[model samples]
Target: MSELSMGDALKLFLQKSRLKGSMQAMQITDIWAELMGKTIARYTDKIQILNRTLFIATSVAPLKNELLFQKEKIIQRVNEALGENLITEIVIR
Candidate 1:
């Protein structure tokens, strides 16, 4: 077997672990502002990932409606940021 670097080993472990979703959620949260802009990120209440679905929570009605229209763009941006097609669906709440 070939040797794996520490970073690669950790990535492998994460890919096979139950914490992957949580980790991905954290990554998204960390980049939320940069990925979606400060205004949107500020209004976003929560972010969660499960079963390849992204859940975005917000109390702002207008923002929610706006998000609904940008679902496809959001998915594309997020997937690009993550360097993988990790999110296949989005739920705006």
Candidate 2:
């Protein structure tokens, strides 16, 4: 087979890491849940994980604001969950 273009590769990744399914993995979801907690998770959704970074989308602007407000803390909490700094950045949009 030929190599995948960036877009194709990303599409395939999204397919495999079905947000709900990906959340099933203890390593990924537990850590995520732990960091954000139930209340925050309800409002925010993990949209993508690319280049070792996490991208989240929030329905509530306040949650987005909170994440921005506690950027460093959130980063640290997420890093702690992953046991290493897998996510270098968190984007809220």
Candidate 3:
């Protein structure tokens, strides 16, 4: 078998572990501002991932409506940023 680099090994482990979703959620949170924008990220109150679904919580009504319309784009941007098709759905609240 070929040797795996440290980064590759860790990635393999994360992929097989139950912490994958949590880890991905953290990663998404970390990059949210950069991924979306300061305005959107600032308005976003919470982010969670479960069963490949992304949940975004924002108290701003206008922002929530805007997010609802951008669900598809958000999924694409998030998955692309993560370098994987990890998010399959999004819930805006």
Q: For each candidate, how many residue pairs have backbone atoms clashing (under 3 Å)?
A: 0, 0, 0
**lDDT (tens digit, per residue) of candidate 2 on 1-93:** 899999888767855775523442345655566667878877776556666666778888888888888877876777676556756787888
In angstroms, the error of model 3 at 85 is: 0.5
Q: How high is each candidate's TM-score? A: 0.95, 0.62, 0.95
lDDT: the better of candidates 1 and 3: 1
- lDDT assessment of candidate 2: 0.68
Off by over 4 Å in 3: none
State in Å the error of residue 48, model 2. Answer: 2.7
Per residue, candidate 3 scores C-alpha lDDT tens digits across 23-83 of 9999999999999999999999999999999999999999999889999999999999989
lDDT of each: 0.95, 0.68, 0.94
lDDT of 1 by residue, 1-93 (tens): 999999999999999999888888999999999999999999999999999999999999999999999999999999999989999999998
Q: List the residue pairs that clash in candidate 3.
A: none
Kindly provide the TM-score of model 2 when superposed on the true structure, using C-alpha atoms: 0.62
